[model samples]
Target: MTGYERYLPILLLVGSNIFMTFAWYGHLKYRSAPILTVIVVSWGIAFFEYILMVPANRIGATVYSAPQLKGMQEVITLLVFAGFSTWYLDQPLKWNHWAGFALIIVAAWLIFLE
Candidate 1:
């Protein structure tokens, strides 16, 4: 595959994860919002995530295995959520959070091993 094809999925996954992180937790900032309102808005946001995620998996499969994709997905989610937690929600991540994420990153690396 060309370099574009190989890397596009990673980019897509990153974008999708951003949407997903917001969808899942953005509502926390607006606690007074009705639950039904939050759920509907979250679902709307998640629709965009699925749009990117489905194609990402389809294309990433060309160069990466299923386990590798899942590993990457989890790592990406953590990274995105970390930033979102701090920047969007004004919540600081503690040392243990970084340590846990580091361990997950190590696991993701293992998934890439032959």
Candidate 2:
């Protein structure tokens, strides 16, 4: 695969994760908002997540196995979530969080070895 084809899916996944992280957790900041309103807004934001995620997996399939793609997505999610929680939500990740994430990275690495 060309460099663009190889990397585009990862980049797309990253962007999608950003939207997803916001969709799921962005509401935490506005706890007083009606539950129905939060759900609707989160769904609206999730629409964009699907828009990117579907294509990311489709294109990614050309270069990586399904397991690899899923592993990549999981690792990406953690990386993105770590930043989102800390920067956007003002929730700093503790050492154990990093340790768990590191273990997940190891798992992803193992998946890629298959």
lDDT of every predicted structure (CA atoms): 0.96, 0.96
Question: TM-score of the candidate numbered 1?
Answer: 0.97
lDDT of 2 by residue, 66-89 (tens): 999999999999999999999989
Give residue 101's error in model 1 in angstroms: 0.6
Error of 1 at 100 (Å): 0.5
> What RMSD does model 1 have?
0.7
Among all windows of ten consecutive residues in candidate 1, which has the lowest summed lDDT?
A: 1-10
Q: Write the per-residue lDDT of candidate 1 for residues 1-114, one digit (tens) a residue.
A: 798768998999999999999999999999999999999999999999999999999999999999999999999999999999999999989999999999999999999999
Write down the worst ten-residue block by lDDT for model 2.
Answer: 1-10
RMSD in Å for all candidates: 0.7, 0.7
Q: List the residue pairs that clash in candidate 2.
A: none
* TM-score of each model, paired residue for residue: 0.97, 0.97
**What lDDT, from 0 to 1, does candidate 1 have?**
0.96
